[model samples]
Target chain A: MNEEENRPVRWNLDDNGVAELIMCDRERNNLFTDSFIDAFLGALSEIEKERPICLLISGLPDVFSGGADKETLLDLCDGKIVVKDLEISERLVAAPFPIVSAMQGHAVGGGLVIGLCSDVMVLARESRYGAVFMNLGFTPGMGTTELLPMAFGPFIASEMMLGGRMFRGSELAERGVPVNAIVPKADVYRRARRIALQIADKPVDSVYLLKYTLSSEKRKRLIDARRNEDLMHRITFPMPETRRRISEQYNE
Target chain B: MTKEEVIEVIKRNIVENLDDVEADSIDATKSMKEYGANSLDMIEVVSTSMRELNIKIPRSELAELGNIDELADKFMEYINKG
Candidate 1:
């Protein structure tokens, strides 16, 4: 396969001081495989070095992310890896520059939570987004318990986390999801680029400081939520039923 | 369309969305889980079925459905109303 086909995640810094991290693991539907995680974190590290004023994160045309890989979940269930091993969400929350999540496709479970960590978000009306950990027979993880409520409000977050139902972006807009914009799928990336460019136009220091100030409280809450979620995962992830679900219910 | 037709639509969508599952083998009395349909697969099945049937049901309302039969019944209710 060519490099584009081989690489799952890639990043580049534009002249306008806006960096883009694009996930394009088409064969895997952007699932968080081990290589994908490594590439994602490595790209983030490289992007940070560029000192971009803003960042835009996106995925393939139809899927922002498919969330945790089934094998990863099975490893967690088998006591081979811990929940903290997945650090994408933590890195997103800790990034120095503001992030615009250009989720022009489906974002499920941890995928949606990571997008929720962004300073701003643009979603596609046709794409589905959900906190679907409960449907996989496990408690929410990757700081989702805190981030979902922060992004979608308390009651809607409760319904999503508890029900584990996938909601279309239009439905989420109707239900008052506080994203920056819910536009046509084709417009999602353009809208996000506009927001990112707007942020990039500001003085770099001012934008950085603003992002830091805005996300500080959220970062603190996420730390606590991660701790609590890890505890819950310890209790819930090892269930025989959860293992069964991971083995049988996972489709891709 | 009748309730049986609704069930057929649902079954057709399920076969299209899920892997290795055939409509002939699908048991209406069993949950989609029994047919190895994951949560995402179920969502696709329900969404496509609703699109084909020209019905819209809130996902929350469909969360507690026990089996394909119950799903068909719920779809029938909306179909009758429309």
Candidate 2:
């Protein structure tokens, strides 16, 4: 089937002047795959064209995204697909309008990077957030290195990346990540939409310019992290240890 | 530097930066992907090439890159312009 008939991301311009891109890969916990990328790109194109005052990203209430799959990662190692083609981190960072993340579920793996890249984040107090890459015997990818330090402090970021720790949404807020709201799981999207509507009520140019002007620091960190993570991933993915880890996971 | 010499530098740098890469797989006309180069590897390769070759490539010019062939040509053009 063509992309439109089966796209995972659902897009709509709400009456409140906000553009909403909700992820609905119910079968996979919204795990990122090629189809997910295609759906996201298609949604991004629509958001760019419409230039809605602001954007909101939401997924299932239990899981923001399951993150990268091992099979696709093996594809990356095999030179079948470039991480650049995924473009989730860069696209979220460079989006012309303010992008808000309605994170109620766990933002694990690649989801963590995307969460930090967003302009504003309102996470559910009970939801989990983490960079669980190290536990899988590989370095994190998709710019988590740069972004974690920028969002969480360097100390926490390092522990999260190196030690594979998971934190509650309230913990991130306590760490000074400026969570716009820390509500219950069911309230995550409603609060995010309220915030998006507030942003949407502002002048479009004002919002875009504000995002561009202030996002430089975060963008720089993302670049540094994206490069370093990808480089380390290159070194680690081909190692026997990581390969064994992958095999172990498959047999499970 | 001659085009052949430049190509040689590119090949050496790729193999050095990426342990998985094989020297024999380096083709003058082929892109870095032929040697299993990813975006991250390519970034390091391009940076090393510029540093070793003493060339300054414009970011816009870098965006238009097609492959290693175009990259070498771009480096030569930058060198000639300098």
Candidate 3:
């Protein structure tokens, strides 16, 4: 089966002008496995072609994402599937519209990386955020190493990924994740919709131009960093320690 | 130590290490996540508890405990099991 068949991304442009990219696959907590990436890339392409005024990327209600699927990582230990996730993450960073992540709970590892690609992040106050790769014996993937340090600065991002620390939404907001507001879990989607509507209410051309203009400088650097990270991932995947760590975690 | 004393140690550890975990009265059954314990924090909690109680726990076993009471119970179990 093709990647999209296993995990599909749905796009719904509502009458109110909120373009929603809702991710399913709650079983793995919507970790954006390889299939999830394939479907999401396709959905993003469709949205770009249609020129949606504002975009809201969300997940199944309670969980935003638990990060990269470990089972999927194990399946492609040679970093084949991980590279695919990196490609999708780059596309998300370069998306034309103002992409807002409506994060609810447990954004970790690559999940937080994808959320960072957004123009604004609206988090549920009680949700958890982490750059969790180091704990799993892997480096940050999917542009996290680059975007995080750029967004959050070197020391903070180092503490997150290298220290394998996780912070609550309110804490992350204080630390500069652009978490504008927090509300009740039920209000996450509605809050995102309200933000999108506010953006849509503006003059479309000006909004589009502003979005492109702001992201242009950082976009190329991030895309290049993603390529470097992907190459490093391929090299790191074959190390004896990497194999032992994976075996230790999964084989038990 | 009294159970309250034990709870206090747990509370202090959580507040000191895990960001946003308030030092409020906590039910043992409440999720550690609800109390702002992430996976890394949980590992620290287990490791700290091991030093206090003198025990070693497999990380897999740590995954089975969900809340403060369950974590305390698992620590006790591991101590006795050892």
Query: Highest DockQ among the candidates is held by which one?
Result: 3
Chain A TM-score of candidate 2 vs. true chain A: 0.91
Candidate 1 per-residue lDDT, tens place, B49-75, comes to: 988989987766788899999999999
Q: Write the per-residue lDDT of candidate 2 for residues A186-245, one digit (tens) a residue.
A: 898888888888888889999889989888887787778777877787787777777666
Decoy 1 TM-score against native? 0.79
For model 2 chain A, give the 10-residue run with minimal summed lDDT: A243-252
Tens-digit lDDT string for candidate 1 (A1-252): 877668999889999999999999988888888888888899999999999999999998889998898889998898786543358888899899999999998899878976988999999876788888987789998888888888889999999899787777777888778879999889999999999999999999999899999999879889989899988888888899999767755642
How high is the lDDT of residue A176 in model 1? 78
In model 3 chain A, which range of ten residues has the least summed lDDT? Answer: A243-252
Q: Which model, 1 or 2, shows the larger DockQ?
A: 1
Q: What is the DockQ ranking, best to worst?
A: 3, 1, 2
Clashing pairs in 2: none
Per-residue accuracy of model 3 over B1-82 as CA lDDT, tens digit each: 4455556677777776665556786677787677756554565666666667677666677676767877777666665666
Q: Which candidate is the best by lDDT?
A: 1
Give the alpha carbon lDDT tens digit for every residue of A53-149 in model 3: 8899998666777666666666556655545776766787777788888887667787787778888777875566778776667677877878887
Kindly report which residue stretches of model 3 are placed more than 4 angstroms away from their true locations once superposed: A1-8, A79-82, A174-178, A182-184, A247-252, B1-8, B15-24, B27-56, B66-70, B76-82
TM-score of chain B of 1: 0.96
